[model samples]
Target: MKNSKVFLSLCAVLFILPSLDAQTKRIKRPKSRVGVGSVDRFVQESFDLYDKVYKYDGYAAAGTPLDDDDIDVLEEALEEMTVLSESAPDIIDDLDGVGVLKQGKATLQMNKAKKALKYSIKTAKELLLGQREREAQENEDDTAETESGDSPDISGTSGNQKDGADVEAEEEPSNISDKLEVYSKFDFVPGDKLLYFDDFSQDFIGDFPSKWNTNGTGEVVTVGSVEGKWFELKGGYGIQFLPLLSEALPEEYTIEFDLLAVVDTKTSSTARLNLTLADNNEFRDGPNKSSVELPLGQFGAFSIRVFNRINGGTVINSSLNANLRQAVLNKPHISVAVNKRRFRLWVNQKKYVDIPQFIAPDKALSHIKFNLLGMRDGVDRLFITNLKVAEGGVDLRRKLMAEGRISTNGILFDSGSANIQPRSLGIVRQISQVLMQDQSIKLNIIGHTDSDGPDEANLALSKARANAVKEALVTIYKISEERLTTEGKGESEPVGDNTTADGKAQNRRVEFVKI
Candidate 1:
């Protein structure tokens, strides 16, 4: 009788399995590739228009948008990006090739679609996990509830339960929820993208990641050749992970690279990797501070410092393993990760550091505090052959950094300073990059001077400096000065101090105050 009962249950499950399988056929999966004769033609036409739109050198073409139907023509083209952003990643390893700047609206639309896809994937994952947990709990509760009742003998009640076996079997597969999850197999946004950061590149973000600003303006970052590095110096951003990070990110993530310094410098003008997580605008409020320094080589080191509004400051209380202690000062394969709040640093694939947990940085859900920024100087060049950002890796600092949003403040030079050095020019271009990310922004350019510089001289100088930068924007950049303004604040306001040379330098600055 026992054997017969077992056989019946097995047969019941087998009979019901096929029906369960059919329910999962809800939405058709995206084809690995989508193309046809007419579809192919449409794609090509859209791409062709894309090329034309991106070439907008700060001005429109003669009688453009067909002289009348700007909205219709552009809207049609923008829609194509929905298909393109999804498929482009498959064809090209680097999403950068999509060239979102091909058109303003199109770029915004593409980002929206991609971001939506990511959220869907996340949701689906959560749903799927919740279902599994529910199923497990149901089973546990059923057993417990059953055990609590009077013990059933091998009699009529047990036979009744067996008769309804098929009903119970039917509920098993409903647990495979149709909802997408965070780790969606098809849609999770690839965290890595190789993007250009030089002045020549176009701004692509429609709704930029938070903490990304070009304010505190000094020099516009642009593409320039560096001796050691292959293509250029400050030419491209190594990895722009997020606009901001609000909390301790994934338990594991890493930013690893094999870099070679172009030249050596003693004044600690070393290339840096910034990990910032804060929303207070004040650097100290968050855990990721510039003060937390990571060392690299003796010639130079890969240092971890608290990086935010105030910039890099050595962490005094850090108890990082001495090996992973210093920043990659000169050049080496360095990896940074944050796991369980503890930061781990690695050099050349070797364990370098294990430091204390940092303060959680997310004050708001939408705001981001995590960031990873690389530094390069004109005097000394650094070649980064492979700079990869992998979320959830052995390196704790790198992990948190992947989610961290980068700030544009450090790109420029000291406050009250207006030299626009070659190094910081890339920064200026970077800021322009942030502005260009959202075309709707109107900017006011204000230049300040140290108190000692003679107010009149400083004011005149400030005005000239603003105009000089304006020329770069109007002429070199071709951005419409329609929304741009230049003002001079000649030492009337001091951000820092003017008594010391450093303070004086800090006081003289040109700002891109948001309008």
Candidate 2:
């Protein structure tokens, strides 16, 4: 009796401890030192279980009962997912460490784990109860001396069908079109000229990028699991980052970059991304604080602060709270258009701030610097990628005569085919408008390709692409085909190196020269 009681006590402890721990235990996430590897590992492990175990066939032949191993794996996956779900919210604050993309992915995976666990638990319980009920019914039928019927019992099957029907009845089709229609409000478009672009592909992983300079430490790391390469800012102590260039920034240029913020832990302290324009061609060190008066002859600045939690903080200065929310919650795509002294900033397709009087008297911005505000050590990281600085509001006449040709990346074609994407319509329309306004002008539409495949294939593709553009101009934009001629360069003249993606993007272009 004593031994049996002891065994029972042991079983109770084994069962109760897990539940207790789960209810009370808090995850100890690294404060200033979480790597992409940690996040990737957790996410990959969670997805592996989701794909291999949760998606695996757990049902038997008749009763559709799950084995002990299947139940255990499902339960394990759910438990692991629960930990991930709890921890993700904490780490997601640092845009560079764990951006909107990974956080969104974690949320989805957690939901899957929940659904799979619920189904498994419910199925197991039902199977056990069903077996007992069948046994009782069979005994009653035997006692009554009933003969076996030609047909099997349909009541059990009908009950399952009814349950399924109830579930189906509860669910409604998603209004996907309605959701998509909401995006009709999005009107953000890229600038016309591509002056300078960097995707961080030219930089080797784990090294500081060659094109950028910073006061504090940072490294170029690839989040290979999620598909991006970024320059991750090391937490603690504010840093100023400047992209190195020989030519001064254009007065009416646009700047764009992708940002991911990661919060080391939940904190009232906000994360800040400050972009300051400097008149001098020299590098300045330390925090790029806009509130503080700069040294003599320096340009102005714009700062954006993203709060950790919703309603956690207020927007200071001219920064938009909506943009702050976007920066904190999603991998924000930042767009800045500087039309001389006037400036406009858009975060994740929404216009955030527009300053008509951005530049001060007697000071024009020659360069720009990125500054990250410091939080707790090991708690915050800011990541930046796809930095593009382009001249906005094109001068068509200047581009044609001064440059001897009008080149554009605006005209695009479908992948692996000569078909045009709908988004290319805007550029095509602009070109058509230019042509229509100047009836005396004739154009030789030439196509160019990156050095990727065979020369012959590239030549064919480029020629086909050029022809397709001409056809689009004639059919859609109603341009005269007789006014246009076509040719292909086939990577013979590349503006950029073929080794990198950014370089390849530059190499693949379409030009219309005076005929």
Candidate 3:
């Protein structure tokens, strides 16, 4: 009777498996607001479920009997697999109208989840059968021992050896050093001097940042699963947010910030975030201005539009589809460099725009403005942080050759971490060029830290960061490791005030000295 029951249960599960596949094929694609975040969350959840099931399968395959709790968990996982498999098709279809970048990611995630679910079902069934067989064998042994007048063996061993069951090994997490290799061709060198820097750390939550002014409402808020404070900008037709600069932007400067957009299918097709350098700091656009506009919606190609005006007359206006829809969904670093009339922009490591005449030569761009267009008031939003504007055009090689040393705050890292920011490679790249040009030049790379943490921890972090820079030069730029030495000064050397934001920004620097 027990065998019959187990057989019936297995038969029922096998029957449902085919039906589930058929249902997925027949179901119509529903209009959903499923964003990249939603798809990522579902994939993570499915993987978690798969992990639980796989562990139980491993134990069962190792000739271990399943405990009551293990069986219950496996039963729950089976139900979860059913639900996840049913939902995957719809979640994948959400990427239909999005750019290939987003589609490719979603498709890969969904396929992985599908395979995990399939293997989970197979393991679950085999586990059930093995448990039933073990129980039956134990009962038969008990009857034989009773008839032979001998005691039953109490050893915790099972003869059932699962054949050909291979568990997949977990992949190792990737390191930042390995990730830096992709930025070998990255040529974005940030400005040498820091003019304006804000990470919103000093601001109170729900309050607008002190250093910025906006025609529309915005407040600093922390996002779920994302680090640091983000200034969330509310969208409207002509909303403009400006950072209050003490002086007009110089002829050579660079601007950088981290951008994240919370969007869905309902996000307007026309919604975009515009970065503008205008003549005036007012809420309106000035006569002389240059703007880079990026679409913030999920349903369109990742495209950028640039507009230039000189003396209240439009001079240059154009747009390009960058095929970066998926990248925009993830938090991306935005870098912009202006050397007199030359304008360049990079999203992370990839340079998207470089124009010789994008900015008018005679016009002075004094103010930086952020504008949001066609986004819903509450449903769609944009968040930005770590805004850094610096004066560029410094000849690092000449300065190093003349002064025998060069120090720069441009080589940034994650908060208290040695992991080099990919954008920071521009400065390091310049150092590598210098090294390549002069093979006999040996140098000492020293790392510094702001006085924010324990002295010992800061010292360790500084050392790790210097070593990371050395690794980048050797691995990415193919510089000789023998010529490069590293040191860490921690917070002992004070070039700037630790008490102020600008001072801290100045203090957290990397120095290359001739040896």
> Which candidate number maximizes TM-score?
3
Q: Count the backbone clashes (under 3 Å) in each candidate.
A: 98, 14, 0
TM-score of 1: 0.25
Taken over the whole model, the C-alpha lDDT of each candidate is: 0.36, 0.53, 0.74
lDDT of 2 by residue, 299-329 (tens): 1222343211112222234433331542453
RMSD of 2: 17.2
TM-score of each: 0.25, 0.50, 0.68
Per-residue lDDT over 246-355 for candidate 3, one digit per residue giving the tens place of the 0 to 100 score: 77899999999988888886777678888998889998776799999877777767578988998889988998767556656778788899988889988777778898
Query: What alpha-carbon RMSD in Å does predicted model 3 have with respect to the real structure?
Result: 12.7
lDDT of 3: 0.74
Error of 1 at 371 (Å): 24
| lDDT (C-alpha) at residue 66 in model 1 | 29
For model 3, state the Cα shift of residue 34 in Å: 18
Error of 1 at 154 (Å): 99
Error at 242, model 1, angstroms: 31
Better of 1 and 2 by TM-score: 2
